[model samples]
Target chain A: MSWAWFHKLGSPKWFFSWSKPWALPLFCFGCLSLLIGLVWGLVFAPADYQQGNSFRIIYIHVPVAMLAQSCYLALGAAGFVFLVWQMKMAPVFIKAMAPIGAVMSLVALVSGAIWGKPTWGTWWVWDARLTSVLVLFFLYMGIIALQNSLEDQVLANKAAAVISVVGLINLPVIKYSVVLLETLHQGPTFTLTKKPEMPAEMWLPLLFAVIGLYCFVAGVVLWRMQSEILMSEHRSSWVKQEVTKHGF
Target chain B: MAFNSLTEFLMMGTHGVYVWSAYGFSTLTLVWLVWNTLATRRKTRDTLRKRFLRNQAR
Candidate 1:
């Protein structure tokens, strides 16, 4: 693939300005879609014949679990970019994404526990899927703590990048944990490789929720990225001009 | 709607506590994360702009 456009993305000023127009709209769309999906999934969608209304939690749980894993993948990819191309924005992306990923992982874990109590009759069990996800949460916390512990920004980014990449090995394990082991956790309701084992009525809102969550994550990242760019590049001429232009 | 009334929806059949707690926690996470990031961004920008202006005066 051509590398020219890829390098252009390295420029924070260009990205900050280029992403501005769509970011707000995307966030609003995410909010709107999530609201609709939640209402549809919780109120209108038929209750599970087995799990009953407890299955309503799936609308939130699945989206967040997917986001937690997806964000880690993103962190790993950004780490790779930082290590290889030394893209300035890549490290900034890693820093910005870590907390967001951590929170999502936490929500996934907590929601899983909540969902588990009613279904499994316990708050937590050392099931394969649950354990792997707990590990994911810890990995996210490790990246955040590691980034903060270092004094030198560049060195910190580099060290964290290595950790992120190494942790990328866990992604497949988390995804396949249920299939590979005897897990109390249910199998994937939505899989890209094959038709989901859920009805259209159930999976349809789930689709919306996933897309909405992704959009939400993207918008929040861009929001933080713009702020990160401004703060980091405050002394740069472009940032100075923008500050004056915006009367900030 | 799956339930017959507002009360039924709140009850969520027999699993009301689990359902509500999960949703409540998820909502809190989403709200708090977004709020904290925006707050941090605003504070950083304000502080940076202040420093920039002070530098300009010197």
Candidate 2:
């Protein structure tokens, strides 16, 4: 396979232009599917015999929790890439994605806590799964804080990359926590190897919710990356032309 | 439909507060992220335009 495409992606100008046309469609489709999934899950799907309507929180909770972990994984990979190849775009991806990841983690934590209230009879627990996710949230915040505190761009990138790379240890711990240690949290609901232990009525809208959330986050990340690119390449003639053309 | 009336739908069989609050908070967070991204993009363009115009006049 040609590595040319990878190299092309390293260029800020190429990325900015390539991504511009994609953001709107992704956002629109994401919003549509997300809305459908939420409404279906909340209003149309039958209530769980045991948990009743509160189980509907799973629609938002699972998707954000899944994305929270995925975002951290992406950060680790990007950190590794930046360290190995000195890829300029890698740090930008990390910078743009950190806040989003942090927010996802926060949502996951809050929603999980909310779900736990009626289900587990508690708002918070220091169990393996829950605590590890809390750690993930802290890791994200630490990276964001590191980037903001450093005045030197190169130093900031290097520091953030190192933290992101090191923090990858948390992902597996978060993944297997429920099984590795007895916890209030349940085991995986969606697994590739086995069919979900849920009825079609329960899992179908969840499918839409997951896909929609991923697309929505992707679109927002692209926009943030574009903004980062423009700021970093402000002096470039292409950026000048691009900005002027937009007439914003 | 899960419930027969709007009131039941809203009440969510007594789990209404927890379910709605979770949804409400998650929705607000996601919306804010999108809004903030667009606002930042616009601000960046505005700053760049002013700089370009300033340099052109010089």
Candidate 3:
């Protein structure tokens, strides 16, 4: 495809119009898939012989934890786009994503703690995996705070971008911290090089949830981006015409 | 397959509290996220509408 097509993505109005058609259906599909996955994994899927029903928590914990890291990567990418191309939508995307990501991380941490209570016989641990994830959560909060605190949007994006890039140094730290610290936390259940040991019956639903959650996040982000575009482009003719056409 | 019956599943072999709490918290977070996203969109639209009217009046 032409690079010009890529450049057009920089236009907020164009993206807003483009995303409008796909948002609702994607959101609906996401919600449906999430519900199905949760029910299937929690109620129908066979539980672990060793961990018993406690392993069901994996349905939520794993997905949220994966999202927690991936969202940060997305933020970092958005920051890079903002800095390099000065995409008007980039800061808005970062703004919208930060709180969502922070909350996801919080959920991951809390769920992991809950899972830990019975499995590990403790709610809190100094284990490397747990500690590093905690740090990641804080990093997400820091980026959000930095963005909110700045008066200038451009400056705020820059500050948050720098923080996000620096924070990326921790994703690997979080992943391998268990190995480094040699703690109670188990090694990876799933890996790029190795197929997950989980049975197809269990993993299928988890995979569905992962895909659904990604779509859900995308739909939310696009919706937020549209609003941001409207806010920032209020003076532009397309936005004015859009508002008029929509009877807003 | 983990439990012999529905009762056992709910009981979770004495770890019910921890298991249920984790699921409960997960559900709450999912609900809250959906609510937050919808509310934000509505609020943004309302604010934009108000601004548009204000500009027109000016």
Candidate 4:
């Protein structure tokens, strides 16, 4: 593929128009996969021999927890794009992604806690995995706060982008903290470096959920990016013609 | 396949509270994310519309 497409992506109008057709179908597919994954995991999958029904929490917990860290990395990537290319749309993406990432972190933390209560016999723990995830949550919140606090949108994006890049240092620490610290938390249940011990039946739905969540995240980001483009390009002739064409 | 009856599924074999709460919270967060994105888009479009009209009238 030509690298020319990457350069074209820097244009807000071009990106907005390109994303329009894919948004609806992607969102629909995401919803469908999520529903199927939920049903398959929650009802059809055999109960864990040890945890029994409580294991169902894995369906939501694993997906959101994975998203929490991945979304931060995404924000950091957007920050790099913003800084290097000075893409007008990059900041908008960073701004829109902040809250969504924060919410994902929140869900991950809360669901983990709930899962812990039944599995670990406590609602809270200072385990490396748990603590690192909490830090991730706070980092997401800090980025969001920084983005909204600045009056100038450009400055806000720059500030948040800086924070996002700094916070990315924590993702590795979160992932490896368990191993490096030798804490109470167990080793990774899923990892690129090791084979997963989970049965196919159990992991299949989790796989679906993870893929679905990714599509959903992309859909949300595209929709938000389009809005950002409209706001930033409000005075541009293309936006005027586009809006008039859409009767909006 | 996991539960024997509807009640058993609802009860989640006495793990109902935690299981239900996790699902409920996940659903709530997803809904909130969708609503926030849609609302932001609407607000942006409205602001652009107003600006376009104001400039046109001038």
Candidate 5:
């Protein structure tokens, strides 16, 4: 209930100390859940009569795809924070998260391509959903490039933030593309208003995989953010003390 | 169990290649993401440590 904790999050030192204890546990839990989900989906869940075992790819595909969109939303929110409030940690979040977002998009695209081969008889499609996601990937790449290319840190952060905030226009496009357009991609598998169309046995492992991937991303973002903090704050005495204490 | 044996599970009733490749590639990438993050952290700290030592010597 206290906004004090929220304000403290803007400080790199506080965030570093707060997140240090959490990173490893989250990463471990993520890996464990992912292991369980993948194995259960592959070995225990019933195979789809339509797509057969290739449907197994859905376990990974859906989670990464979902993450791809949500991560972009995070980036946009961080950008907004950086531009409006000028929070020091906001740009760090952007820098740390951009590569992860890019990689997640890559994984989703690749996994979906692999899944498409068996189910759709094609490896690639120019459908609205697919094309928009491809643009999303490019948008992530552009943000990363913008951040790295500028020698001036302030300018780089500003430019990246601008792009990130503007790029938010695409999320809704990606979300609605399947429904709004005549596409080969299926409609939403999971929605809050109604239960998923699939049986519990099938969607349950998917649920695990989704939650696991989210935890995994959170842990990684924390790790990367800590690293970014140390690098950016290296000249500060507390950072020096941390570096000495950790002996890294 | 969805399949009768490990072999059947691996084969995935003839959809093995597609299923396995997707999992394999994505898993490798995820592993790389973790590896890269840690490596960057270590590398950053190492640079900072060396800078400290250098400053002390100076």
Candidate 6:
């Protein structure tokens, strides 16, 4: 296979132009899917045997939780490329993503806690899975804080990259914490190898929710990346022309 | 529909508090993120355009 596409992706200009066509469509898809999932899960899906109606929280909780973890993993990947190849776009990617990741982590933690109240009989716990996700939230904060604090952009990027890459160790810990350690949290609900613990009617809407949330996250990420591309390339002729073309 | 009426849907069979809060908070957060991204993009474009114009006059 050819690596030309990968190298092309490294070019901010190429990526900005290339991404223009798909971003809005993806956002619309997210909104539509979200509507479908919400209606289905709320009005159609059957209640859980144990958790009762409270299980409805899973529709948002699972998807946002996945987004939380996925964002950090993506940041680490970008951080890796930044450190190794010194890819300029990598730092922009990081800058764009950390806030979204932080927010996702926060939403996951809060919603999980709320879900816990009726199910687990408490608002918070020091369980391995929950605690690791907490750490993930802090790690995202550290990246954003570290980036903002340093006056020198290069120094800031280097430090943030180090922190992001190192924090990658926490991802696996978060994922396996329930299984490897005794915890209030449940094990995987929807895994590839095993049949879902949920029945078709219950999990089917969940599938739509998950896909919708992924699309939403992707759209927002692309939106921020586009901004980052514009900001970083403000001095370039194409950016000037591009900005003007947009009636800005 | 899972519920017999709108009131039952709202009640959520006594789990309404927990379920509604989760959905409310999450949906608000996601919407806020989208709005913020657009606002930030607009701000960046204006600042950069102003700088470009200022440089041109110099």
What interface RMSD does each of the candidate structures achieve? 1.4, 1.0, 2.3, 1.2, 1.0, 1.2
Query: Tens digit of lDDT per residue, candidate 3, span A154-237?
Result: 788888887877788888888887666778787766688978888898888898888788778778777777777887787888
**Model 1 docking category:** medium
Ranking by TM-score: 2, 5, 6, 1, 4, 3
Candidate 5 per-residue lDDT over residues A117-227, each given as its tens digit? 889999999989999999999999999999999999999999999999999999999999988899989898898899998999999999999999999999999999999
Clash count of each predicted structure: 0, 0, 0, 0, 0, 0
State fnat for each of the candidate structures: 0.76, 0.83, 0.56, 0.78, 0.94, 0.74
The TM-score of chain B in candidate 1 is: 0.91
Better of 1 and 5 by TM-score: 5
Candidate 4 similarity to native, TM-score: 0.94
Residue-level lDDT of model 4, residues B15-54, one tens digit each, is 9999999999899989999998889888887777777888
Q: Residues A25-134, candidate 2: write the lDDT tens digits.
A: 99889888888898999999999999889999999999999999999999999999999999999999999999999999999999999999999999998988999999
Predict model 3's lDDT versus the native. 0.82
The residue-by-residue lDDT of candidate 4 on A1-248, one tens digit each, is 79888888788888888888887788878888888888999988998898889989988888888888899999899888888888777787887788878888899889888888988889888877888888988888888788778798778888888888888888998888878886655566678876778888888898888888878888887888788788778778999887756853
TM-score of chain B of each: 0.91, 0.96, 0.75, 0.92, 0.94, 0.90
Over 4 Å off in model 5, which ranges? none
Q: Could you report the Cα RMSD, in angstroms, for every candidate shown?
A: 1.3, 0.9, 1.9, 1.7, 1.0, 1.2
> Which residues of candidate 6, in runs, are more than 4 Å off?
none
- Candidate 3 Cα deviation (angstroms), residue A24: 1.9
Q: What tens digits encode model 5's per-residue C-alpha lDDT throughout B15-43?
A: 99999999999989999999999999999
lDDT tens per residue, model 1, B1-58: 6789999999999999999999999999899988987897788767877777888899
Give the best candidate by TM-score: 2
What is the DockQ for all candidates, taken in turn?
0.75, 0.84, 0.58, 0.77, 0.87, 0.77
- lDDT, each prediction: 0.89, 0.93, 0.82, 0.84, 0.93, 0.90
